[model samples]
Target: MQRLQAFKYELMPNGEQQRNMRRFAGACRFVFNKALALQKDRQAQGEKKLSYAAICKALVEWKQQAQTLWLNETPSQALQQSLKDLDRAYSNFFAKRAAFPRFKKKGQRNSFRYPQGCKIDQANSRLFLPKLGWLRYRNSREVLGEIKQITVSHHAGKWFVSIQTEREVAQPVPQGGIVGIDMGIARFATLSDGSFIAPANSFKRHQAGLRKAQQALSRKTKFSNNWKKAKARVQRLHARISNVRKDFLHQATTAISQNHAIVCIEDLKVRNMSKSAAGSAEQPGRNVRAKAGLNKAILDQSWFEFRRQLSYKLAWQGGHLIAVPPRNTSRTCPCCDHVSADNRRTQARFECVACGLDENADVVGAINVLRAGHARLACEVNAEVMASAAGTHRGDLAA
Candidate 1:
């Protein structure tokens, strides 16, 4: 089986190389925003959207123009790749998979991708880009497989390189029985086997420091050196919080994926759940402050990232991840199969009104999810069997 993976490492570029990388990132951002604006203009004029080739032609024209001649200094291929990214974004929008493409802003996710023209010398711990000469990177781990693409990104005052590679490996044989998980604020994840993971709460732990930094930043004059320093402090704090949460999630997901052949979880729409409680101008919302705090906690937990990691990791390990509809997983009683909102009178406790089965609310939810996943998997297998039988019968009739 073929597997694709990305290896990331911090880059140790010289002063000139750092300046060039920044300029390249800025050029890519400019090209993306300019291309997006052109698309918007075309749409507003009731004209068809420009195809990728048409946009590439426009890019050439922009380069030739006198005012934007500096764009020539940046890697042409990198600029074209930025336009390709916009095209992909538009594709996602038209397919209803994502929101409309938005203009890129400076200093946020500054990056450039190289489809080709990159050389890596792991022995020397350096890689070569098209415009930027050989740059040193911290070779934390040996890179595997053939390089597919390279992405250079700036984050938290550091430059990093991500090398995506492809390789072949033996298909994994899944092990262990199926289990269900209940994700929550108090407990990060509760398993059907009566085990639970504690919440990382990285942001909550550092919220006070972040608030103080922001307060100091607000007091500084705009564009002052002190303001920039304070802003960097805030960014670094955010980066630390993110790194802590990511490390925790990686460990938890890896353990679950390795041990469980099948994992079931509720199909939670985290975006909708974390939406702001503030209402429109005509209608105000109650408990806005409480809801805001709840939303922050939900985002901090990174539930969506958890599920995403599980999905791919399970596939890699020949395991399965099932997401059952979250209609009544929490309210239903696992003992009597009775469904009622009254069963969950509080957040932590669950007591069935009909059969008097008592358990933790999260545990009950996990139990129901496990049962639902069993039924769902059974239905899928039966459907496949039936389809195979039907195809065989048709072949016999034709013979």
Candidate 2:
């Protein structure tokens, strides 16, 4: 099976290299925004808008003749590809997969990636690029198999490189165990085996520091050096929260994938569910304070990220990750298939009105997921066998 894997490394670049990286990122961003503006202007004037290739030509001209300052800096083809990425993003938005392309704000930007023409050789802990020469990397994890491409990115005022590679898939290790997992804000996840992973609430733990940093940033004059420093501080806090959440997800997914041959979960519409309504004196949930805190906490649960990790990891391990349509899964009783919204009296309690079976609400959800998985498995097996028989019958007829 073909799979894409990324190996991330922390970069140890000197002052000049760091400055060059920043300049390249700035130049790419400048070209993209300028091209977008030019395109919009031409459209407004009823003229033919510039194509991506045309915009790239303009960037080349600027680099060569107009601005000889960055002439020695040397531009990469990857920089040109950034504009294409922006175009694709806008295209996706038009196709309704994403929101309208937002003009990237200076301070709010995290990092840019060298999506093309980059190389990494972990054996030497060095990365080569179009402009910058081979730079040393602080690689901790072993780069698996053969390298394909390397991407340079920055986060929390720190530089990092990601190496994408391809490798032979490992042989499947039999676990013989199956599990159903229910993810929620209150308890993170509850499994079919009646075990639960408690919510870490990493954001909540670091909220005070983040808020203070943001406040400090707000007080700093915009575009000033102090503002930049404060902004970096805030970004560092955000990065800490993200790191904590990612670590938790990695550990949890690894544990589940290792122990379970088949893992079932709900296909939750997290984005829809996470949407907030305005709260007033009468509509309390939609109020600013309530919505901000509650929604932030729920989003920090990172259900989507957890599901995403489980998906690829399980596939790599030859384990199955099953998602069931999330219809009345929590309301229905696993034992008797009794469905009632009132079955859940409280967030933690689930008492089936018909079967009179009491259990943890999350456990009930897990069991329902397991049943759904089993039903799907049976259907798939039957479909495969039927297809096989049909193929054999056709062969016999041809004979």
Candidate 3:
């Protein structure tokens, strides 16, 4: 089996390389914004949208133009890749997968990709990019597989590289037990086996410091050195919090995926769950503050990120992930199949009126999820069997 993986490392670029990297990122951002502007203008003028090839052809002319001749300093491929990214963004917008492409702002997620001419030196802990020469990086782990692409990005005043690689590996035989997970803000995850993964709440942990940093930033003069310093501090804090949350999710998901052959979870629509509940002035919404707090908690839990990590990890390990409908999972009784709003006596407890079975609400939800997943799997098997039998019957009739 073949699998794709990304390994990221912090780069220790010298002054010259750092300047070059900044320029390269700026060039890519400029190209993306220009292309987007051109597309929007064409749309307004009733002209056909420019394809990737057309954009690339225009980019060649753009570099040759007198005013934009500085673009020649950057890697040609990087500019082309930026156009490709813009095209993809437009495609995603048309397909309703994402919002329309927006102009890139300076000092915000600056990045450029090198699809070719990237070499990694494990012995020297160095990486080679197209225009940028050999740059040292902290090689925390061995880079596995063949490198397909390398992305250099600037975040929190630091430069980093993400190397995406593809490799062939033997698929492992399915092993370990089946389990169901109930995800919540109070607890990160509650398993059918009665075990729980604790929430990290990384943002909450640093909330006070972050608030202080933001206040200091607000007091600083705009475009001043102090303001820039304060902004960097805030960005660093945000990056730290994000790193903590990502690490927690990765660890939890890895453990769960490694231990379960068939993992069942709720099909949660996180975007819908976290929507703002504030209504218009004509019809004021109740519990506005409470809903805001709830939204924060829901986003802090990173339920969607957890599920995404679990999905890929499980696939890599030859395990299965099943998502069951979340409706009535907490109210339904696993032992008696009784489902009612009254069954959930409180947020933490469940007591089925029809069967007198009592359990923790999360644990009961996990049990119901497990049951639903089992039923779904069984139905699929039966359908497959019936289809095979029907095919055989049709063949017999033809004979």
Question: Candidates' TM-scores?
Answer: 0.97, 0.89, 0.98
Assess each prediction's global lDDT (C-alpha) against the native: 0.95, 0.82, 0.94
lDDT of 2 by residue, 1-399 (tens): 677799887899989999988877776666667777777788799998566778778777767675544633646565676678777876887799998666665544535566556666768888787678789998787887676766677788888887888887657774757888998878899998899999989999998999899999999999899998898888889899999999999999998888888999999988887786764677565366776676788799999999999998888788998899989989998888889998998999999999899999999999899889899989999999999999999999999
Tens-digit per-residue lDDT, 135-166, candidate 3: 99999999999999999999999999999999
| Candidate 3 local distance difference test against the native | 0.94
Error of 3 at 358 (Å): 1.7
Candidate 1 wrong stretches, greater than 4 Å: none
Worst 10-residue lDDT window, candidate 3: 171-180
Q: How far is candidate 1 from the true structure (C-alpha RMSD, Å)?
A: 1.2
On TM-score, the stronger of 1 and 2 is 1
lDDT leader: 1
How does residue 91 of candidate 2 score in lDDT?
Answer: 81
Q: What's the true lDDT of residue 48 in model 1?
A: 100
